[model samples]
Target: MTLTNEFFQQLESLFPKAADSPWYVYAALVFQANDRMELISSTWRYVQSTTSKAEDQIVKARKMREALLKASVLVGFPKGINACTTLRKALLADSPEIESELDKDSSLRQHLSRSEKDARGMDFFSKIYAQHTDRVLQNMSVASGGDLSEFAINAVYGDLMAEESRLNAKETGLLEFLACYATGGSVWAQAKGHMYGSHNLGNGKAEIQGAVKICDTIEETLDIKVNRAPAENWSWLAKAEKW
Candidate 1:
């Protein structure tokens, strides 16, 4: 699907224009997960042209890369791999010099031991899951015979989502939310979990509601339809603090 200037104007209305806000990155991730590769480069280019400063572009670019990496756990590696490659090529074509500003080896994986990584992962998982932590873990263990639970804590949470040097807890949580949302309505339960996770990380209810609207806009713009859950499925978020 072709992403028009008008479409991006709609996105800018929904999110802040700051580099840290990086709504385009989230949009790119959504497009990538949905197999709309044609729109990915244009989305990145639109953000780059509107960003005004060189340093800010670098920051947004890095966050885009980090988001693709972290969200891979939910959206699958093939899409993540293609998205990263596409973004990198787009960055190079636009401003080859900006590549040097990015971190060559930003991940903490090399610096931490396996046990330490697991601890970091569990800590992050606990923070996101909050009151639901134990129950979620128990459910995963029961559902997958302990394998999924163990991998989620040690690998997905520890190895990826817990890395906050680039994207903070809230941003990472939002990526998780977007990744699940992009995959379509069948994964709404997973999307709801990450939406709550984003809220737990300090996103306001209205902010997330705006994100949901943005996702809807993306789907509608592309003329792609999937059986999404009803809006009532998320009404409980109005009382998020209790859960």
Candidate 2:
């Protein structure tokens, strides 16, 4: 199916625009939209295929393990962590301090119930992000022999920053990132506060509905694999040669 305006808007809602990203950021956005769909689909099957109700909680508790494995395979550790942490930060930015406190304590939590715990598992997904970030820094530092290479460190920094910027432009926080970057100074400060109001998040739900159709298509269509990389050996491959 074609991506609707509503779909792009939903992607933008999650990752606000910033100066650091290239236009191909849209590819990442589409992949993310698809990933969310795959995740919910996987979870549902895990629930439905179980033979007994007693096994439900046991399987559900392992959802993080499942997601983590999927992430390691799909994007390796750093990119996966970067995605999860950025999304978590975006979620917090949307709600902020008192709003988050209220979300935790309010009837919304009651409404979400067990799902809230799964939502919070987004935080645990960041372990790989941190692990890979440290690895990149260490390798590049050693490559430069303890002194930071203006070229090497900046190259590494640029990749990390681009990932951050890509997340800003594609999903939950892009508008805020765009607004703050464009406005600068105190206007930027005010922009952050202005982000709390609601807008249609579009078919994040419908994307879930279409997930099963997309799953088999993924290997051929998207080349996603769930256990493809070991985080320790992961390195940022340059997209092109330096000028």
Candidate 3:
């Protein structure tokens, strides 16, 4: 879909300007977008299927699980503690396939089982950002209306900012920033607030320049400009929190 004026205005309400991220961040944006879509899509299905009270809900839940699990591999997002205890527990409670697979993933967790250890192990951000990264996650969770919780936030970002990651925080933040921008909805604004507020992005004008470049990259990659027919407008992001 084209990025509409309404969307941009809503985004600027929170972010003020586009950010200039590193090259790897640009690349990560594409894959991250796909991962985020996988998350959004699967979440909807899980919600719909679970509340249906139909026998076939399991079938649908199973399919959604497949997609979400795959997305996790690509984006390195471990299902958060809340997701695990709530939806994952219910969905996998009786399903052998889901249980067996979730057991092996190592990313999904039923509680904040590894956060402190993960935090201690991390060496990704410099001393300052690393120390304060969890605070950033708290801010993001609050801005996302709790859709992105601390556990879920840590599962995904912990790896992204890990000491040995191929992608640096600057790169991670840029792609992350663009991924939020691509959402083109209220979530986009929230995403922008969290990302722009984070420390990984370039300072001042670099971010603005990066925003322009990110938009251009989106155009080139999608082979469609946000200025074109505006394609079917859709912006409501799944409340990808509980499930």
Candidate 4:
């Protein structure tokens, strides 16, 4: 499956009512992570037309750019770099003025030291993982002899996801889920963790379900088979609603 205009319309229908939500960005990232470079421009055009308005086109572009940057860690830098470059091309063609609005030094994390990134990352990580943060970090430490956990906290969480200049915590949390989902079935465990993180960040059940439905739709449309977890594994989400 190729991304057709019909698929684009279907994807657009799945988006939340809020125009500024990162879910729009996720649509483009999905194709990027899947190595569908051919579809990226069309996807960007769809996203750009729908989300970018005259008043806030620059804001929307920055948010989309930031989401792509944050998702790079999960999907790989090569794809991320290509996606960003393609998106810039699309933006330039469609709205040259908005393209000019972007900052030369877009990353706020570049100015910070390692310790600052760690502190910021830990703070964001604590918010998402909540009570399970310690256990999760401990497991990562044990699994990788501490290197993996430290890198995850300091680099991924602190340096990337924690950056709120454009995408906020809630948006980044949802982006995590989308990024993992786009990578396919191999990382469902990580995807589920981010789904829970979305919940922890105050995403309602309906909203999370909408995101999942979008992923399911994309997989089906693309004729891609992902080994998604069984329904029983998601029962906790329903249970958590009561708690």
Candidate 5:
């Protein structure tokens, strides 16, 4: 279904301070509902018209191109290669000297003026990446997992193969789910379940390797909780009561 006014209204209410802001969610909604070619063309025209008004054409163009690339990815385009290449060509055409002049531009700063928003976006993106990558790895494992014995009881009970063809993350909502699943607990049982659900660990041989790699990544980069319970600061709140 097309994104109704209700959706935008709900989002606006949920994020009142971000009303009409140039955020991914807003752009994603448009991408989900609109035609990609028209959207990209319109966005290019808008950037051309508005960059002068924004007082820094080069910086504004870069941001618009970045947004276009993100939206393209959400709409099932190959963002890492094709969509990015297209966007970059568009940017260079619009501002042929953007790369050379970018360093000297005073008005076109890093847009850290909204550090809070930037931080929030980065945190969200990082968590999304961690979870989605984990899922892709897991699904590959299960589909490739050779023996049924490799999978734990839960995977068998849940029938993980039902999602055989559609395992990759195509939408933001799916990414959010993967992130939530990886948020806590480090016991062998939990790890097995996580690994099993991915479909990659279905084969006994791949299961162990998958688990190890996931664990290593989580330990190094993810703020994972192997032993801690997932909560909104129960420990710190308890400590604060002492003060």
Candidate 6:
């Protein structure tokens, strides 16, 4: 079935402003359908014709991508990796040197301007190490204890795994999924738990699957490999969500 109005209604109930512009919903819908390579292809095609017109549309597209990230997070949609990567890819392809162009945009400059977006990354190592006292110390209690567990988890999950500058949790989730899909490691297992806990318990089953499905689409379109490990059984529904 197509993404129904009811689906948006559910999302709107979560974020009243999400319904303000169709871009957010439209991005979600296209990703859900996973048709014709979806967002990346769409953005690529638009960029081609919009070279002269693209200056303005480019700004709009950036806004739409940001909105998509926010909306996905609020609605618990998990396609943020695709959204983040495809949006960036299209933007880069459209303008090989976007750093200056993005800065020139009066509307988008504040958020995306290099100074702002690249202002800083979370020292998540410090944050999680500071936050998850129990988890950290608990592991330390075991033979696998010492600075090793803290360093490893904080380095991978905390440092590398957590956060992209302009992305939110949903986008970050998908980013994590992409990495896990590629590596086929413990992170994939963690992502599966996150899907079950956050998205699946909510009205987000299709969204989670869409995240996985896009991995295939990405491999096809980008000619990369994914789901390198089935031992994690990420393909399994873990007993599906009603949607």
Residue lDDT tens for model 5, 128-240 = 33445445435546776834322311232112211112221222222222222333343333333333333332222232232233333333432333444455422322321
Candidate 1 colliding pairs = none
Please give the distance, in angstroms, between residue 175's alpha carbon in candidate 3 and its true position after superposition: 1.5
Winning model by lDDT:
1
lDDT of each: 0.78, 0.31, 0.41, 0.76, 0.35, 0.44
Instruction: Report the C-alpha lDDT of model 3 over 22-49, residue by residue, as the tens digit.
Output: 3322322332444323323333333443
TM-score of 2: 0.22
**Top candidate, metric TM-score:** 1
The TM-score, computed over Cα atoms with residue i paired to residue i, of candidate 4 is 0.87
lDDT of 4: 0.76
Which ranges in model 1 have alpha carbons more than 4 Å from their true place? 16-19, 230-243
Candidate 2, 164-201: lDDT as tens digits: 21132122222222222222234433222212110121
Alpha carbon lDDT at 242, candidate 3: 16
Worst 10-residue lDDT window, candidate 2? 234-243
> Which ten residues in a row are the worst by lDDT in model 4?
234-243
Report RMSD for candidate 4.
2.6
TM-score of each: 0.90, 0.22, 0.38, 0.87, 0.31, 0.42
Estimate the Cα RMSD of every predicted model relative to the unseen true structure: 2.5, 19.0, 14.9, 2.6, 18.1, 10.2
Worst 10 residues of 6 by lDDT: 14-23
- Tens-digit lDDT track of model 1 for 196-234: 888888777555765666777888888878665587765
